[model samples]
Target: MENKTNNYSYLRFAQEGKECIYDLFDAFLKKTIIEDRAIDFSKSMTVGDDGSIEFVTLEKDGAEVAFSELVGGDPSYKSVFELYLRRKACKAKDQLTARLALACAHLHWLWSLGMDCKTSCGMYGEAISVEEHWMDSLEDYNRESGLWHVNLSEAGVKQDLTLVFAIFHRFVTWPTRPQFKSVNQVKTALVEFVFKSKKNSGAPVRNGLLHLCDPDKYINWYSFESKTMFVTFHSEYLRGYKVSDYSELLAQDSLYYTRKYPKGMKLDPYQANRTEEKICYIFDRMEDNMPA
Candidate 1:
């Protein structure tokens, strides 16, 4: 029922999604180094410029090992880990080294399970995606659904195995931090709060990258006719911005409110928030129409 071959080669790749070297390290961080069987995560981090974290030391059973040396022991993870260190060592767009590695890894794990993984590259603060923007940019030359190309098509298989796991981690996992009970709730919050903002109509703006706009400064441009952006994020864009900025926005608000209603009086007790989405995994493949 499960393919636990090659020390779970396929499953590990699917779990981490090659988002970056950090993600790969993260998997082991959850498993080897920090996982209870051998490594415990009672480690210290030394922060570098721009909030970057460097693993300093790991303590276990009163034994301390240099973090870098501990990582070098694993051949599978060690290779890429070395590369990440080299990138940091050279200072090449050094701040974005992590981001680019995450991007380059892309969604290979998702692709492995036979899904058309769509990705778009843009500036740092840009919206990585907006379905509205993607659809509007179709050119006339295309036929059949007006899609430009077929990227992940090798034919799909209806193979289900126990150890194999996959997911759309960001879209699915993000709602968790925001406290939404389900993905649908996240969708509802987006539709009610963001999609209808500033025009209440889904007006398509090319380069619709969600640059953060202060509600007070851009009220005329950001405000929906009747609804206010009550949540931390502005209308459609999800972001984790600077503390000073977030703090300022919250203080200026008659927008965000707190209600002391009894437990069941609330709107399903579903809260919403967003965090930086680093990985997306595809846990299953059950159809033959698509390709991997």
Candidate 2:
């Protein structure tokens, strides 16, 4: 059962984790606005001393209705908002389910090869490993231990799958968790746990698992360049970034890929390519294709 209000309440918060009037307005605007029409904020809006959007009035057809009144009277806005929330929740659920399936299969593949975490970590990028770089590891695991061939009979694999489920479950239910004030807080803890020590032997394993959970947010951490880029440039990306904003961007990206690519042509049939890598690849291609 999904709490539909999870995204609704989260959209109310600004980047600093404080609720913001503009953010709330933006949420409605995003869902309900017509592309061709623009609200003239100069006359139709009011700002408070605290920098909040104090009031709004929308004008159309030579008439004006108070935005607050429209919101109060219109059930359509509520319907649209709820619809959007359901779509977001559905996408999130799908992402989690597919990732969990892959994780279970990956763990089974490792166990079948008589590999513990230690052996898998040591054999990163090797032929007989599922702990390799992001792209190939997923391919290998999906090819070898797909749900059809996955073995849950092994006690060790079952134990590891339980732990994986717990970690992934924390993220799925994080919206209602009191300790995590926002997704950013949960993401911060994830970053610390996943990439805490670069030299740690389990770095590859940690990276692969986290990436499996959320490719849009988590980078493939085994590569040195990925770590360097994250350390150097991730903060710049975070400027003015809210958890809600991140979610919306993901929705946009997902939509773009869905419209542009056929199912089999996608980079990873299971999930989106890691966002960091895609951005860097775009930059490199732009440079290479430049007309000198």
Candidate 1 shows a clash count of 9
Give residue 196's error in model 2 in angstroms: 0.9
The runs of at least 3 residues in candidate 2 whose Cα sits more than 4 Å from the true structure, single-residue gaps closed, are 1-178, 182-184, 197-199, 210-214, 217-292
Give lDDT: candidate 1, residue 37. Answer: 23
Per-residue lDDT of 1-292 in model 1, one digit per residue for the tens?
A: 1111112223322222222222222332233223212222223323334333333333445875332332223334433433543342422254344332322222222122122233221121132221112212222211122111223243221111100111111122233335545323433343323222232222211001010111111111111211122222232232332333465444534332222225553322111111111110111111222476
Q: Rate the local accuracy (lDDT) of all candidates.
A: 0.24, 0.32
Report lDDT (Cα) of residue 106, candidate 1. Answer: 26
Best by lDDT: 2
State the weakest 10-residue window (summed lDDT) of model 2: 139-148
lDDT digits (tens) for residues 1-292 of candidate 2: 1111123232211122112212222322332221212222223234334433322333456765322222222334334322432341322235333323333333333333322222121211222222333212111122222111222343334333333333333333335433544434444554433332222132234444443323344443433334444434534444333343466545645432211224554232211233444444444454566899
**Cα RMSD for predicted model 1:** 21.0
- Candidate 2 residue 15 Cα shift, in angstroms, is 26
